[model samples]
Target: MRKTLCDTLGIEHPIVGFTPSEHVAAAISRAGGLGVLGCVRFNDPDELDGVLDWMDANTDGKPYGVDVVMPAKVPTEGAAVDLEQLIPPEHREFVRRTLDELGVPELPEGEQKQDGVLGWLHSVARSHVDVALRHPVRLIANALGSPPVDVIERAHGHGLLVAALAGKAEHAVRHVDKGVDIVVAQGHEAGGHTGEIATMVLVPEIVDAVGDRVPVLAAGGIGSGRQVAAALALGASGAWMGSYWLTTTEYQQIPGNAATQQALLAAGSSDTVRTRIYTGKPARLLKTRWTDAWSAPGAPEPLPMPLQNVLVSEAHQRITRSADPTVVSMPVGQVVGRMNKVRPVADVMADLLAELDETIVKLSDLR
Candidate 1:
């Protein structure tokens, strides 16, 4: 797995783990793979700055990256109050009715409801970039698609490599054309916002389209060393894995996520469903009663991007607080099936490398 990506990113392996947990990200970097922290979860730049400060102190000086959500076409941007006002009454009623039907409880008396992710807005995402640039980040990845030209240029000016997630061959080409240094061909099986292309088909098509121009990382349904080897065989410089890290012990340490972890541990490969109910885009999420309710008759069409998220944000909180594993809303790939047991990030990374080596030897023997 010692591809040019390893040398470029200054890691021992070509595996790049995408995680939202700072501890998980640091652990991955310390274990020799580049860990890219998801930045959209941080609505406050100062908070993100403090977290990055912690990351800098930790990770043993190993390289790490940051992923930001910058939609190509900007969405409705405003204050939380203004955005709340934009949500239709019908949508609000739907959320309320659904929560009631699910028996989700209200927050504790003093607990204030958390707002939806503001990072979906371009302005907020740009602030993320501004904060990230001030850190020692080696790479900046856009979760939605190619970032703005000036943003890409600014990252380049800071001597950071820019990567964009692409779900199609054309999208990959466009990323390269827009001066993106890396293209992550994330398939439909991927979590969060995704397109209809499967990894097995999308990886090779993207590699053929832009592998010669820039390194392509294969994402979606990749959790083990065998999948990493397959990604390399398909011309990817590395495997970009997100879902596989969710069950790591580091992530398990996060507060109020035990129910979510239990749901992931109980899932199988066939248990996932791709639905627009998550983020108002086709995203693979764990099949649960929450997702099921969205498909029932008379379920209104999900609002686009930020608005839909805003509408359902508190509902998600209520469900999580309800501590019902069967009703928790989480964006996870089909790989969640394999995420059965919790292990240290170091152990997982070791297993991945060991499995990759064993797989490589087996493939070599076929000759």
Candidate 2:
């Protein structure tokens, strides 16, 4: 699977693994793939600094990246207090009621819940960029859109690549125009925030549109080596996989949320739904009671990004702490059907390469 992307990123495989866990990221890079660490969950710059420090020490001098959510626009303005006030009481009450109905219990008196929507702000995202650049990060990716031009230029100044995720071909062009080094064409089948397009159609469209300008990485519903091969066949230089890494042992080691992993293992492709109930964007999430509640009649409309995210942050923390399977909201792709068991990151990477080689041989034999 060695391609131009591999050369560009100085990796052996054209696979780019996206995960929130630093262990998983380092493992992917050590296994000859580029690991992109998700930074949206880090509310404190020091927290991110610690993770990057661990990654830098553990990646065996391999290339890895950082992913941040830098939306082109936001609803709240001025200060953090202003942003919290943007969330209406009704929305907050709805979230609380949904959790109550799902039997998700509140956290213990001494323990505190994590801040969910803090990192989505521009200031926090900028702090992430600042922290990542201080380290030897090879790439910095923005999940929402093309990061500010200043971010792009700053990354370039440090000899780092800037990547952006686009759901449409035009979005890819815009990213390229903004000096993005890589464009990840994530389909509607992807986890977290996504747009309405399938990978098969979106990949080639993005490839044809920006094939000559920049490298394209295909995402969404891609969990296996066959899917990676298909992405390369469609002219993508690599496969940017997120859902596939969720079940890795390295990921499980972080926080060790076995309930979430168990839910993913028990899921089929159809067990997911695209709804804005989670992050106020059209994101694919596990069809649990929380997601189903939002679709019920008389359910209030979800507020826009940041507002809706803030509305449900505490509820999510409660559900997570409770470890309730029915109420857990894990962002996953349609490819969850294949994630049936937990495995080590090294073993998963080796199996993927082996499968790719076998698939290639079979194809060559057919001719």
Candidate 3:
């Protein structure tokens, strides 16, 4: 309650709910926490505008943030990609053959009309950032790495806070030097694209590395109030959470689609692996038939972001909509193991805050 983050963000609770679903975003903010809408899933700025407009209408004046996938390190812009270029014929053939053998047919166009290309690269994400800032988004967070200098400058120009995730101490320094308002020490256990350091080790290292230049939000494998308290103890201002929200009632996921996501966390750590089957980036996902097929010794390696991502987007989208347990594999982290049940988003936030209060009280009562 007393942390600078809560004060700075003007929220009743320090809990930050990260979800891409606009309804989930509004629900979390209405529940007294900040809701962050993940924008990497959007194909273009227009799609982002639609979501932001809906969020603006639903959030009842509560503040929320937007997340973009601006990787700090990327191949030269436009050097390789002509977004207009379709997937390679060979790769496209492979997907079609696999689907045919599996009897998965393309849905009738009567399904939702898809927006433009996916936004997982620096160039496309900048456009997303522009759309997000033009709206009332209170914060801008970069999911991949340090926020770009121009991104940070633009966020500050619009009077918004900017945060970036780092998987190492060195990345934390890069974020600080670029004027990031918050540094999320994201461990390898986080969902989606993550670097290779464990959160327990990375959080303290990054906090120390930054040396109070910016606040740190400890992430990766953090789900419970005890974990949040630990992050604060590790010198972070708070915890930045993702996986914990994936199984909530408001998830865009179909009801039964959560099993695999849940199992990734419940099973051994080996249950998960960094593969690009879903997004083409080295995102940490549960080892599913989908991922295993892509990573098998003989299979072609997953492509880079956006390219690899679009390859599987149709399947991921259709399955999530179908809510068919047999055909779906949701993206999640090792923390999904802790996401044991489907609960209300508000209830989840309340439990976290109550647990945090209990943690603080218990610590004070000691001795």
Candidate 4:
């Protein structure tokens, strides 16, 4: 696991754990992998700045990174109020009807609904970049695609490596061309927003296209040490894992997450479905009644990038508040099948390395 990426990022293993939990991210770094915090959950730059401060104190001086949601092509940008106007009434009604059908309860009286994630907007994402640059972050990753050229340049100026998620070889090439320091070749089986290529094929294709120019990190459906070995065999410098971390004990510490964790523990590899109902982009999510309802007859087509998320943001809150595991909305990969137990992040990291070593010895004996 001691690849160039490890040396570049100053970590023991080449694994990069992406998580929204600051605790999980810090734990991964302390355990020797670079933990990249997902910044999209923070709608306010000050909130992100405070979290980074906590990360700085908790990571034990280990290098960690931040992942932002800056799309290659900017989406409609505006204040939350202005963006709310763009959502069609039909979509709002659909969300309301679905929540009613699912028996999801609303917030208590006088408890206002939390605003939609403004981080999906370009302005908010850029603010994330600005806040991240001020921290001691070693890497900055864009979740959607290649970030704007100026953003890439700014990260470089701060002496930070820039990485972008690519679902295609062409997208990988484009990232390298735009001066991206790393490319995360995330496959169709990945959580959150993703494309149609599977990891087994996408990794090598991306490596062949840009491996010589920049290190490619293989993502999607990677959860164990054996899978990490496979990623290395496919020429990836490291493995970028997201979904597997969701069941970590540290992640379970997040308030109101028990139901979502329970759902992940109960899932199998075949229990996932790729749908555009999440973030208005094709994202792999746990198969739940909510996702199924979006596919039913008379369900309107999902709107594009930010709008769909805004329209359904309140509905997601209601679902989470409802505490129904069968109806919770979560972006997770097929790896959820293997995420049966809630263990410490350190324990999971140890198992991954142990499995990788065992796999290496088995393969060497065959020679």
Candidate 5:
């Protein structure tokens, strides 16, 4: 459906897809929606640059954005090696023992491991911002709270719109006050990091609070076209979708992702739990044995943000390399129950639009 958000971003649809794959991003843009590439995986500027280059070449002159986890709070200074030393021995032992008990094997040989630097750090995220600004990115979204004033000003100076995800009504107000062009009110049913409020309650609250100043995008448990229509009804100018793209064909085609896709397919809505086991932030993850182990008696408390992230970085590498679905930690939303099969991005969008039209017709008929 066409909305002010589409006109503001110069896109044909008011759908904004947040994904980590450049392929998925490009495909969404090519399908008339804006694709926001999640840059948390790219700790290296050069690697991020390469992905941006690919997106630029493949987007066919459509608009796209970049998302970075530039949290409002983080350690001011510390090397990865120094941060690694801060993780307690018991926490490390638990991760090691849990994987062992799950029978998850290690990598075969010569597979590259994820660097433990943890891109959520302020410095690394800023570096990503630097790289993104050099490209033709139309928008820059922050995964955490309102971006710093300077970052907002910087993006504005470059003639790019800035957006941020807020889980609370007050957070949306704060984001707009800080000059964010868009505020994504992501509820608890969302994938990854989330808040306590559900989408149904949070979206309208945020819209009522700041809809006059800026557009609000509805996120959390939004997968179907009906949900998109519902978001528009709640006063959101668009739907900011993340989890919907996880099972897309382009995502399943990524190397070392077969297990992830299978796990997501096998999971139901109740199969997920909100825990800080992965990123030290309360993110919704598939309730696997690895996550359950963290909740058992005598388990060490999870370290905050960067610390917990560093502690499990290596263990996550081993688990992924092993390709064991039982121990894999996949972040997804309750709407995951709707993600039953793999489809192409274009097909997903088309189905969503069809559903949206049908929903609107049904609502209109109710009168």
Candidate 6:
């Protein structure tokens, strides 16, 4: 727990919990660890403000962070073609039918929902950044890649630390070049959008590539203290985690979104198909019937971001409303196999720190 992460973050434990729930955020920060709030699901700025404000009041000013999904590769930013123009009407129809087939009913009457018109593209991402910067957050983490240069500059200007995820050394190098404070070397075993590199290989590679330039935190397939030990042994300052926190007592699990169902659907979603159903990026997901149907040889090709996200957003909404975890997929990594039990947030933190200490002591004995 005395690593650079703990020292830099001024926490007694380096256990960073990633969850969208503000309750978990406050709990983790209260327990002396970084509680990173995920913002991809929230398209509203006011909702984010309320959540962060509540967390700030509850955590007694203990440091916490928020993560946003701003992919480095937007469909048509650097290219000539427009992403929206590229989407086909048949693809849209297919998505509508997919939702209909799933039986996700329309929202009840008078359910006022605020949705951004441009979707999660660059402009909306920047707006979310503005909303986040207004709150009392210690870190600004970009989940997909290097945050926009302007965003990073703005965070640094406000004295906030900026971090980004990397699947390779060159990606880490780009982040460092862009003045990213931390590089999370994500591997294939990670849930959501990930690269092909494995954690064991990518961590050291990033460390060497970064040198003394910036700190590197290992990600992907890191669910326990042993995995954190492996990351530190490979020269990372700490471990950035995601999948491990999904099954905690604080998470909003649907009826069957348990360990058994995760394993049962593991062969389908966990088999590692990088599809664009979620965010229009090469994200890893459980190879479910939906993803398989979209990825099948004769099936329609996935649409680009924003548009693709819009296509499946209705489907996800219906699935979650129905609480059917079998056909409705949750983004998770291979670490799902290990998250068989649910414990309190503080209890989970204690177990991780204790296990890390034991692992470190045993390794010292070995040396």
Off by over 4 Å in 6: 75-86, 100-119, 253-272
Flag regions of model 1 displaced more than 4 Å: none
lDDT of each: 0.91, 0.88, 0.75, 0.92, 0.88, 0.74
Per-residue alpha-carbon lDDT of candidate 5 for residues 1-367, written as tens digits (9 for 90 to 100): 2467898998998899999889899999999999999998886889999989999999999999999997767653477778878888988888888878888876567776666646788788888889999999999999998888998899999989999999999988988999999999999999999999999999999999995889889999899999999999988889999988989998975787788888888888898899988788899998888889899998888988888878888788787777878878778889888888999999999999999999999999999
Instruction: Summarize candidate 4's per-residue lDDT along 25-113 as a digit string, tens digits.
Output: 99999999999999997998999999999999999999999999988778898888998999989989988989889889887798788
What does candidate 3 score on TM? Answer: 0.88
Clashes of 6: 3
* Best-matching candidate per lDDT: 4
Candidate 1 lDDT, tens digit per residue, 15-82?
89999999999999999999999998788999999999999999999999999999887888898889
Off by over 4 Å in 4: none
Residue-by-residue lDDT tens digits, candidate 3, 134-159: 89988899887777787799899999
* Cα RMSD for candidates in order: 1.0, 1.3, 3.2, 0.9, 1.3, 3.7
Clashing residue pairs found in predicted model 1: none
Q: What is the number of backbone collisions in each predicted candidate, taken in the order shown?
A: 0, 0, 2, 0, 0, 3
Q: Residue by residue across 1-367, what tens digits does model 6's lDDT show?
A: 2367787776667667677677777788888888898887666677778878888798877899988878787643421135435568888688767666656566567764323223356666677789889987888888877888989999999989998989989999999999998888888888888888888888999999999887788888887889888888898888788877766676643343453244433443245466677766777776666676676676677767666665565566555555555455566777766776667778878877788889999999996
Per residue, candidate 2 scores C-alpha lDDT tens digits across 1-367 of: 2467788898999889999889999999999999999998898899999999999999999999999988877545445456678778888888778888888887889786656666778888999999999999999999998899999999999999999999999989999999999999999899888999999999999999996889999999888878888888888888899999998888888663788999999999999999887777788999998899999998999888777777788888888788878888888999999999999999999988888778878889999
Off by over 4 Å in 3: 75-86, 100-103, 109-117, 252-270
Task: Give the clashing pairs for model 3.
Answer: 265-337, 266-337
